[model samples]
Target: MKYNKKAMTKLINQHRELHDELKKIKVEMGLEKNLAIKTLFHSMVADNGPYMKEYQELERMQ
Candidate 1:
């Protein structure tokens, strides 16, 4: 299937924005020293890591 370039670019940009927000949250959690929440967050990120890498590859291709 064909994809719309502009739409895909916008989608990726939004994905990057969301990822940045996640990083910000990580810092906030670290500051709070919330061990349990930090452990859960790390697990969630690890599970999603593959998909995140794929998106990054796509961005590089563009």
Candidate 2:
């Protein structure tokens, strides 16, 4: 099977934007200070870290 690399790249970018927006909201609303909440937020951000690798590989391809 084949895929459109540009479309995939755009999708990844959109997801990253959404991620950042959510992170911003958490900060703006002061939700990151609680220990449990901060841990969760950090974990969520860590999960997104791997996507950066995938996005880089895709960008290198097309």
Candidate 3:
């Protein structure tokens, strides 16, 4: 399947932005004692980081 380069670039950028925001939120919420929220955000940050990396790699290969 072929992808539009412009659209892929935009998608990668959006993913990058979301990954960054999630990291920031995780840091800002560091002092919170809510284990559930912290765990959820931690997982989200972890997942997003890898996904963004994969997306960037795919974009580069395009």
Candidate 4:
């Protein structure tokens, strides 16, 4: 299916917003200031960072 430019722009913006929110959540969980949270986030990023496309696709459907 072809999406119009405006729809694509909106989807991109939504994806960015989700990413920023996740970053904020990670920071607020003390990941940036605590060792354990940092380790968890690091491991998660290493193992699943590339799966964000699935999350983005799901988010777009909402």
Report the error of model 1 at residue 22, Å. 0.6
lDDT of 3 by residue, 2-27 (tens): 33344343443567654465456558
Give candidate 1 misplaced runs (Cα > 4 Å). Answer: 1-14, 31-62
The digit string of per-residue lDDT tens for model 2 on 1-62 reads 12334634353355765456555656777665244333333443334643445445565667
- Superposed by TM-score, candidate 2 places the C-alpha of residue 16 at a distance from the truth, in angstroms, of 0.5
Candidate 1 backbone overlaps, count: 0
lDDT of 4 by residue, 2-61 (tens): 223343334334566534644665676655423432343343323455433443454467
After superposition, which runs of candidate 4 have C-alpha atoms over 4 Å from their true positions?
1-14, 31-62
Write one digit per residue (lDDT tens) for candidate 1, span 1-62: 12334433344355665446445666866643244334333443234643345444555666
Count of steric clashes across candidates, in order: 0, 0, 0, 0
Ranking by TM-score: 4, 3, 2, 1
Against the reference, the lDDT scores of all candidates come to 0.44, 0.47, 0.47, 0.43
TM of each candidate vs. truth:
0.27, 0.27, 0.28, 0.28
The runs of at least 3 residues in candidate 2 whose Cα sits more than 4 Å from the true structure, single-residue gaps closed, are 1-14, 32-62
Please state the error at residue 37 of candidate 3 in Å: 8.4
Ten-residue stretch with the least lDDT total in model 3: 32-41
Ranking by lDDT: 2, 3, 1, 4
Work out how many backbone clashes candidate 2 has.
0
Q: Model 3, clash count?
A: 0
TM-score of 3: 0.28
- Please give the lDDT score at residue 26 for candidate 4: 62
